[model samples]
Target chain A: MKKIKTANYDICFGIEGYAVLGQYLNEKKYSKIIILTDSNCNEHCLPHFLSNLPTHILFEIIEIEPGEEFKNLEIFTGILQTMTELEADRKSVMITVGGGVVSDLGGFVASVYMRGIDCINIPTTLLAMVDASVGGKTGVDLEGIKNCVGTFSMPRMVIVDTSYLETLNGRQIRAGYAEMLKHGLIYDAAYYDYLKDISNIDFEDLSLLIFHSVYIKNEIVSQDPEESGLRKILNFGHTVGHAIESYFLTQNNKNPLLHGEAVAVGMVIEAYISTQLSSFSKDDYEDIKKTIHNIYEKVQIQADDIEQILSWIKFDKKNYNGNIYSVLLSNKGKAEYDFLISKDLVIRGFKEYLK
Target chain B: MKKIKTANYDICFGIEGYAVLGQYLNEKKYSKIIILTDSNCNEHCLPHFLSNLPTHILFEIIEIEPGEEFKNLEIFTGILQTMTELEADRKSVMITVGGGVVSDLGGFVASVYMRGIDCINIPTTLLAMVDASVGGKTGVDLEGIKNCVGTFSMPRMVIVDTSYLETLNGRQIRAGYAEMLKHGLIYDAAYYDYLKDISNIDFEDLSLLIFHSVYIKNEIVSQDPEESGLRKILNFGHTVGHAIESYFLTQNNKNPLLHGEAVAVGMVIEAYISTQLSSFSKDDYEDIKKTIHNIYEKVQIQADDIEQILSWIKFDKKNYNGNIYSVLLSNKGKAEYDFLISKDLVIRGFKEYLK
Candidate 1:
């Protein structure tokens, strides 16, 4: 087992780390258990998880609607109703077993159930295992707004068994891999170098790389658990990435860009802004752009579209005092905070990405 | 203005203290604002609040259905959809301006909106301004379970304008008064002495008592924000109170006990438990019983009802390690924790209350 400790959170990774579930449950002495999952994990992933549990233990499975749109108050109510019908009490524990959406919604449910209850996370998707599961962020989307409702309730334990990755689709794998690459670019250049030959890597190697990526995120989260200072570094690509995602979400014809895909593009564009304002070399900016573009197909950004997307920047969660603050790269592996880049620079970055 | 400071939380009471709303919003630099209210408050209390706002500032109001049944997933979704339609950006703040239900649901909405946003609570009801507004607890009810879905997200500011209580119904005023009596029974003899003549008090004096009650709750909360230790003292009457409340909820009875009403009875019954297990004087237990019976009508507790209520105790939020933990007062002004009194003792206590 790989024992990883960050300032605010500690996570254990590897093959049989799944055992941590039973151990923590025993320690907390929860008598009743409820497992929350989506339709996807209920069929493909939950059986593998259930095989490890003791048969005598009484537990119930709450299946919510699958995907991001389902991550809202409707599904949250469903889980609560299920818990109520099953007579799941305050001593009951909810075990989330799916991707980020499932964990986020389930964690929100547990946090509010009778004002709060203990929960354990068994993240099935790579995006969740490396990022969502470790942090204390639990919430669901509201209407067209993404992640509009949530809480910062930490789980008692997070069991990440990469064995679940075997069933992930190619699109899902690549989407998750984009975030891992981001961890490398934002914090450790050594990891970036390791990820350069991504197309040639095997699944086992991919899992090991994911563990390392989670370690970097875990380290930063532990130090700034509340996202007051160092934790903002984890949102390196998210500033522009979220705006781009929202832009696509508002447009009817274009396919919605996956979270990691949007961030990959965001990293490239923000890198261009970095070269303009900081000591980042032209060569380094090109390398970062080339690395992300190699894996993520570039989306077209027309002049009109650039104007629309720039308008959404003010809506970014990090904005304060009417200024859109972008998390920029001061250097290849270091992130700088709270830079109020101008609208012209944002338009210029979008133009550079289009080229 | 009454300026009171607890160890961690500060309570600013009185009419002009509502200006704290503008200061917090200006300091946080919120670009847009939305005020959440219920029908009751909108008609009776909102004019008092809105007249205080700057004339140039435009704030949207979202009205939700009032009462415990409305505090569910359906309303949570309705509010989310409303916020989305209004284009409530991440920089927008949600100001909850009603009783406990509105504050709880609105705070939960803010905690999850865009993964979290700033929320300010302007509590109108006496129960809300004193008890609900101070704690960081925010949630909605699910099925028959009260506050089953929630998060512990603190508000940027909690504006307590006791002047709103002038419009409260006679029952609403008495309901809030019960909680004040509870604070005295568990932590302060002087406060209890003050509440002895509570029946003769007018609305203006009730406002002063509400401030004092909130002060006691805020002090307890500051010391144990997470409810791990001394905070359990606040649950003094909640154990049996909650069970009785739940029991009544399961039946199709008219005029079910409100939260405060059930708690008033719970205090009486738990006092008997305290007398059995500790240095609690018989005189004090009888006084508690007689006092609550005088203010609130006694509900008949048959043998079958006691068994049903006892069964519900296991589901209490404070339960740990399969053991039913009760917070009992060793005497007035002192509380004992983790007392694992037997079911027989609880039944005996119920019998004592019956006599």
Candidate 2:
């Protein structure tokens, strides 16, 4: 059992995570408990959660459609209205029991309801447990813009039980793994090197790796929770990655790339840019591309898609003063942020990724 | 000019407030400035505000319809969408120049835009200057639930210029005056005595009185920013007051009560509750009723409206554990909170208020 503590809340991994979560629910004496989950987790993970939850406190389960598409202002307002209808008072606590969409939207709703109530996150997906579980970031996408509306309200507790990871498919696990890989690529070369052997990641190895990834994220987030400076490093691949993700999600002509797949491709393109624009090694960029490509198949990006993606990049939350700022790797396990990336180089990076 | 400092920001009264505001804006170097105003303030006060704003920094004006009715989810999301369209970056600052509705909605928008941004509130109404100006509470209503969705994000600064009061009509001034009376009723007997001579409140007297109201509120809010304890005193009249306001707001049969007027009636009824339930004196309650009645006309509350208002009270944000919790006065300048109030007594108090 590993207990990782961030600035405001504590995270626990494995079965012990449930123990901590159950203990927290008992101590908080909340007026009632609300469990927010997506349809996917409602089917796969909720029964297990209810059985393990040791509180007799009245709990209600609210299920939304299971996908990023449902994460919008409309869904957020609907949940708030439902909570109101349920007469959920100020002291009520919401336990978000699913992946990132559930947690992000639930965390946001809980944070803003009555100017915030206590929330506990029990992330069921690998992507959520490894990435979204920490950092105190909660938001819903607005107008096809990802995370355009949000707040930095931490949950009362975060329970990252790895047993639920068994519920995820290989594609989903690899998508979450992309964040872990990017974490290592930017902060710890040795961790990256260890994770490079993409095949045969048994449950035990994945659990420890998830722990490492969360540790890396929390460490960065704690230093700059608002993403003022150090936290921007976490957006290393997300600059181009999020743009690509948004473009594909909105276009609907092709199947949308999962977050990690988009980010995996983003990391490769950024790494390529790093080699050309900064002191990053060409060999290292090639190595990163190879490792990510091993886990994620190459995404088909046509010329038109590139233009739309670049336009989305202009609205990247990380940018300031109308300039495109991208995080670049100076070397393996080290990154620099707020670099002025010209559209020319960004286009060239896309060209390199196409090859 | 009197400067009152709260936990996170400073509030200034009179002309010097503008000096502080101008200085802060020049120092922050925000990418852009977005001035948010309600329809009333946009027409009546914007030109004066723009002329006085001593900065060459680019600014855009976003206006919403003026009224508590407009303070809801649709408008909040609309402003956020407009912001996204304006390319309002995280570095942009929002200067809210209206009454409580504008400040509440705009402050919430700025706070949640990209998980928070800099916001400076320039409150343009007397009620706003004395009350809303100090509290970091920012929110928009959901489904007619007043301020149901919001945050505690403070402004970078607050500027209270009493000159704007000249633009308000007599009813508007009295409406705001009710909150100042609330500040006195709950915290300072001397201030209450001073304000009771309502007719002779010239500009100078109003300016100093507004300063006092803000000071008392700031002291209490600073001690308990999240309203876990001391801050609950601020909600003294708001229990019944808010219900009355909401009932009138949703029911178009009667003219909607301004926030302060609803609060004025709320304070009188709660004072009655205090005398019955706590150590409060009946004489003090009569004194409050007389003083309030002297300034405001009697509101006609039909028995049905009373029942509806009582039901609205059940959904009060101050509620906990499916119970109605109200702040009651023990005497003038003294109060207690989290007291469970019965429906029978609340109904009787409304009858007393009618009488």
Model 1 score (lDDT): 0.79
| Candidate with maximal TM-score | 2
How does residue B13 of candidate 2 score in lDDT?
72
For candidate 2, give the lDDT of residue B96: 95
Over the stretch A1-355, how does candidate 2's per-residue lDDT look in tens digits?
A: 7889888989987776777777777788889998999888889999888888777789988989988888999999999999999999899999999988999999999999999998889999899998886788999998778899999988878888888988999999989999998899889999999999888678889988998999999889999888889999999999899889888888867787788888998899899899988999999998988887777788988888898899998778878789999999999999999888888888888888878
Cα distance off (Å), candidate 2, residue A138: 0.4
Give the per-residue lDDT digits (tens) of candidate 2, residues B1-355: 7788777888877676776788788898888899999888989899988888888778999999989999999999999999988899888999999999999999999989988899998888998898775688999877667788999888889989988998999899999999888888889999998999798789888888888889898888888898888899889889898999888998867788899899889988899889889999999999999999999988889898888889888778889888899999887888889889998888889889889
Best by lDDT: 2
Range of the 10 consecutive residues with the lowest summed lDDT in candidate 2 chain B: B12-21
State every prediction's TM-score relative to the real structure: 0.87, 0.99
Model 2 residue A182 distance off true place after TM-score fit, in angstroms = 1.0
Give me candidate 1's TM-score against the actual structure: 0.87
Chain B: TM-scores of all predictions: 0.93, 0.98
